[model samples]
Target chain A: MIKADYNVFDTTHDTQYIYRKLLDCMARPGKIQSIQSVTRKLNDFPDGLSTLLAIALTLVDREVSYHLISDQSNRVHNYLKWKTFSEQASIENTDYLFINQNLGEDKIYQLMSLVKKGTLEDPHQSATIILHVDELSIDQNKRQAFHLSGPGINGVTTCYVKGLPIAWIKQRQIINSEYPIGVDFILTTTAGEIMAIPRTTVIERKEE
Target chain B: MGYVAVTGGRTAIENANKLVHSYRLKDAERAIEVKEIESQMRLLVDRVMGEGGLYAPEYAALALKQTEGDVHEAAFLLRAYRSTLPRNHYSMITDPGEMRGIRRISSSFKDIPGGQVLGPTYDYTHRLLNFDLRNESGAVEQFLEDFALELDTEMDTPSFPKVMDLLREQGLVANRKIDEVEPFDITREKLAFPAPRSARLQLLSRGETGAMTALAYSSMRGYGAVHPTIGELRVGYSEVHIPYPFADEEEDSIYIGELKLTEVETVNSFTQNNQGDVEFMLGYGLTFGQNEVKAIAMAILERSLETQGQSPTQDEEFVLLHIDSVEAQGFVSHLKLPHYITFQSMLDRIRQAQKESKVETGSKG
Candidate 1:
């Protein structure tokens, strides 16, 4: 008898709304979407955990395994396990990896390298890395800007981010060199904003 | 004249829906109750349960009444309802040999264990309709009272051994090692060509009964080479259990409930094994509720798919893709939807071709 708390988020309607937002972002890479309205209704979650929890509650279930990085106290991990009934797996075998932006660049690189890239036969088996970042904006004033051109974009679209490491993008490029066999990235902010960079998208750094 | 798109289509659709409701209530007789349909139309409810792939009898009855007794539409409703649900647990593997059978029979042997108890079947009944059912309120109670006296209440219910087991013991049936691999769930994953046996079985078990019967009939009528004898057909209740989530021991499980099922095992022609020993092949089918025809047809088509042949029934993709009632009915019924633009485009192409042909004929003359 697994008891789950439903007060913070509705299992049906909330998850459905979050899933639709995530799907829209995934389809149009570099497109920013906000779920602040939904997350604002939630309370008592630590800084940045509410947005990540919203995503986890939408995608994570008993069918998949997840790994949470940068949670030294395992609070998020335990809550996720209790709420979603999902098992905690190692980085390599996990289907979803939730990473905090505070994690060092070196650790992020190591984790990204070890994550599953799937196989030629079943590319959908690949892992999805959800990274908590500071901010995502369409304005070019942010610290780093990426010009994305892919199946989802019309031709090229530039998206700016504040706290994501440039090295991680390079590592993603290397891992995704072989088409259709790579991890997808969903960058979420503390303010409940999200933008996706699917493996099909080609990202290039825009010079200031 | 060019096809003109209408503006009041929404009002028309709304009125059409209202008209459907009106038609359902036009009869002066009382509206049929869901419970009555479930209990009185047992076989029809069973057919919907099998085809809809949902075992909720009350919900199946509701779908039947809502669809005005259209089995296809009722099944579509149930399947659509099933999609909104979340899958929480996978049940433990069940064995049909443990079923408490209400009806059991075997065509391969005249006298078998359990002695062919034909419980609540119309097989031996005449096809003629009796007028007595028009006013059957008193007859129902009287018949039940009379029938109860004839039943042997003192005897304990007997369990029977599987007919296939006897053949296996005699080395007459081919040896098949138990496949312990986790069965593929067709609902979770999109089906691809050259599907695994688990996916094939999942699709066939919930397939449309009339379509499956027709395909099986085609095979029997010389379209294919599979003709099988019923090894055993059993309609019974089977228990379902799920692993307890918080249990410390692996053996700990919770008994969820029981389901009424129809299981069929068919014995086919002999085939040589890798070592050149000849043995009879087998086809198996199982579905929710007591749907004997669907179960038998499923067994025939299951075996037909295994054989290498040019027949449509032997084509896995052809048979499996077309057998889904919801998919088949949806595709066919979608033709009734507006296709004005497409038809207009086709008409334009034909008119241009006619003009070009006329110019060519005039120039040649």
Candidate 2:
């Protein structure tokens, strides 16, 4: 049995539970939910950032080559190390990537550099990313936005999230140049919420 | 300014060894002796080896003591240790028919060949605990001699066909054959779904005993409807045959694996088909010790699983997926690690979500 404290849980176990819950969420598609006791002790990293650790530990191990990118690679690396048991590698050679940056053209371009796109035979083996975004939303016109359409969404509805750089959308439009090969993203909140936007999702920037 | 130093590989290796030593030595006074564990707790030791997928009885016994009786952890320890040992040779698959006789039974036809040798069986014993076993000695040999004296000579009988084969011969059922791709060993590779049937059975065979029993019980209770009959259940020692590259197959010593006395049984063809006779041998369940029920359930579930209907037992994918004790325990218990980097990612996402919607962000939880 896992020990729990005063509404506080070990980030490790919490991440594992969250991993299963996230799997359920992803498979079900478009279900918005939050997990408890996950981010309570994740002090240095963002709240709910433990979700990334959950993903890493569940997915990455001795077998997978991974790269953890952040300016403060030292602190984050230690926690990542303890969480994932993953051996580190340079950004270029990574099979899985964890990026902590804003969602702008520069950041988007920065991430795109690491995309392997994979081979034609094994599409699932391609490089995947967990991009950390700060804010996302629509412009004043409400037309230039991330109006979504997919399995979970009932219809084409425009929903806005803030703190993301407008350039991120621009970069996706460029990546849209090719299909069947691109990156997948799981936009997770410091509060442990996540929205998965694979390379297949279309994104366009609003023109002033 | 907040970034910590990257520790060198040398120091990390030393620290890791220290951790392993500490874990191994946690129980100082009650350190479990390997020999006693092997002798007294034979079944548990056998189970550890059986599920661990290792054939070393002593090592499995040693691991059981180290784990303080956590069967899954003991299996894990044995497996982790086994992984380091290089594969020197491949074992020639032993034919179960060649097994030296100790005990054998057939439910389909009770009065068949060998007259149901009930050798070394605990079936007829009452539930009362016997304290006299501690003092008993040479009782087995005496019993064996007395049973032989009654028989003038073993009666010669032809090897009978399997119970399922009878159903298949009449064509009263459709032959349900599943053609799936090769599977990666779960221990050697990461788990992904929808996994192939081979992978699922590998996971389920070594699954936690209680959890698996519950699921099996549920299937019988109509959560999943599977009517299974005992085809054959046998307990005895079969030679472990390992084949060397240069040696002939008859040289059994070339194989380096243990053939512990085991009890393996499988469910027979219980398919109720008025239209046709469907015949299938569900599982060839193999285990280390006298684990009759587990092996039988495993076989029944395997047969039931291949059929793609809505029986609780019929949902092979679901039962196979969730019933793995080792993987489930490992991943669930693994939540004790740290994840500050992921938290940072979460912080970034929520701030963006809040800003886009113009909602005041709550303090990072």
* Number of the predicted model whose lDDT against the real structure is largest: 1
Model 1 stretches with alpha carbons more than 4 Å out: A1-7, A27-45, A72-78, A118-123, A135-162, A177-181, A199-208, B1-8, B138-158, B352-365
Q: What TM-score, to 2 decimals, does candidate 2 have?
A: 0.49
By summed lDDT, the worst window of 10 consecutive residues in model 2 chain B runs over B155-164
**Stretches > 4 Å off in candidate 2:** A1-208, B1-32, B131-184, B189-194, B247-258, B261-284, B335-365
The TM-score values for the models, in the order shown, are: 0.88, 0.49
Which pairs clash in the backbone of model 1?
Answer: none
Chain B TM-score against the true chain B, each candidate: 0.95, 0.69
TM-score of model 1 vs. true structure: 0.88
Candidate 2 lDDT tens digits, A53-164: 5566555664576776666667666665555445577666677887664544665687776566665566666666766655333333433346555554556545455555
lDDT digits (tens) for residues B1-365 of candidate 2: 36444455778789987887788777586666789899878778877877787778889888987776889899889878988653444456566555655566766556644557676666899999898887768877876888785554544322333344444456533444545555557666666776676777677667666666777777777776555666566665667765444333546455454475444445545565555544444454555666666666676677667767776667756777666666778888866544466668899999988796665343342
Fnat for model 1 comes to: 0.07
| The candidate that achieves the highest DockQ relative to the unseen native structure | 1
Per-candidate total of colliding backbone pairs: 0, 40
